[model samples]
Target: MKLRDLGGVVLAVLLLAGCSTSPVTEGQAKAISSDRVYAPDLVGRADSESAKATFLRDEGYFGSGCSHVIYVNNRKAFAIRQGEGVSLRLQPGEYSFRLETGAGMCPNIATSQDITLKPGSAVTYRILLPSDGNLRLTRIQ
Candidate 1:
């Protein structure tokens, strides 16, 4: 192959390597789940005044190989893998939910929404990562 052709091939390889979308391994996922530290005030106490919130990821073909970090009320809640979901019991109040791309992955792909939770109520939110690489939060319930 010509020198110029070889250069082109090398450039393509570099670009593809930089565009990695590898999914989180099982061990990494477990570590992420175990490393989460919730606020002490938010830990126990399930009662009539507590509200339930569920977050689900889209798991669509486009970005299903990547994991995202979820932040609740500006606190690091947990990491949500593709097609996975998590539920939390929170005190009835207003909360802000945000999603971000995992480390070494896409940049500038964060989205958030504010929701008010009432006692004895349950709410569900879905995270969508479209082709544009921007995160979208939608309320499905």
Candidate 2:
């Protein structure tokens, strides 16, 4: 109602806005440091019935109930060594990713995503090469 009162209110608002945000440092953001990565030991195999390519839950977080199915096709294919497996470390957020065996079940792909990973935790997903081959799923603590 008064000029002096209005000026005080504006000053308070400005101060609050100024204190709202501060630039984040690397340490504070927790950017993926090399030390935080723990590659999971995944073993690939073929499906028994189909005799096609399939990945099984072998080591690490295998049997931890984090099992999932993923499809990898020529379009969205991610190359993985025949014997050597791959690992990914994700922070707290929602990630959409695709995995492929690099080689067919009609579409020759099983896709899963919209995965909500918790902070400081991980999940394991596998793709079986053969219908009955050994596929390994592992999670890291």
Candidate 3:
């Protein structure tokens, strides 16, 4: 490749990268905004003393038909489908969270994460199945 052509190629690559975003900002930005929370059947009602927790399922084709389960402090909290979300008003404390699909790669894996939520504060978690098919529970915002 010529030097001038390579410079042009590098510029193009940089511009493309700039146009994209991190994984946390990805997947239906319009729907995942803080105000647009999903509250099916008024699940997890929040009071002035409760912290808001939201979980969003990735908008991917992998495991689209499977139900994604959310465990808060080792208890079954919510089950969400693809491109869907759930909001829970939880009591603030140190919490352990885990995600399970019961299908796809590493189905029985017990990978989990922990977070400390404060009363009257809000947080969100995202469930994603990447190209490799491993399930992940990521805290986004």
Candidate 4:
């Protein structure tokens, strides 16, 4: 094979590797629940003593159909499917949210913000899978 052709093959392999999707294991799938109900009308109130935070993974029809395991403050919170979401009532404080597929290739993705929750505030975070195949957290509210 020509040297140029060999380089092209190498580039293709690398690109495919980066675009690979993490497979959801049976245990991980079992750990995820699809029963969470999202109430749009219910949110944090100004007079309330706690805040409401919701994590949504809205991949629509473009997702790989794999369940993504979510971790809040290092504890297994719940799993969400495409177009599904989960919510938590939290005290006013700083928190860390992480998402992982429990796959071997794809590493855990986390929120980049300070994630400070204030009393009577409601925040919604959407998990986005961009064209580059990396997971990102974006605040929609």
Which candidate's lDDT is highest?
A: 1
lDDT of 2 by residue, 1-141 (tens): 999999999998876554332222222332222332223211222223211222222222211222233333222223432222334433445555454332321234344444555554445444333323333232222
Local accuracy of candidate 4 as per-residue lDDT tens digits, 15-51? 6655443433222322124343222222323347788
Displacement of residue 100 (Cα, Å) in model 1 is 1.3
lDDT of 1 by residue, 21-131 (tens): 433322232222444534434434578889987766654466655668778888877876665666678988899988888565556577888888999998877777766
Choose the strongest candidate by TM-score: 1
- Model 1: weakest 10-residue lDDT segment is 23-32
Model 2, runs deviating above 4 Å:
1-78, 101-110, 132-141
Scored by Cα lDDT, where does model 4 land? 0.60
Pairs with steric clashes in candidate 1: none
TM-score of each: 0.66, 0.33, 0.65, 0.59
The per-candidate count of clashes, in order, stands at 0, 33, 0, 0
User: In model 3, how large is the Cα lDDT of residue 98?
Assistant: 82
What's the candidate order when arranged by decreasing TM-score?
1, 3, 4, 2
Q: What is the lDDT, from 0 to 100, of the residue 23 in candidate 4?
A: 34
Model 3 clash tally? 0
Candidate 3: worst 10 consecutive residues by lDDT?
29-38
- Global local distance difference test of model 2: 0.35
Model 3 over residues 8-88: C-alpha lDDT tens digits?
999988765543323433345323333332333335467888888777776655566566667777776666666676667
- In TM-score terms, candidate 1 sits at 0.66
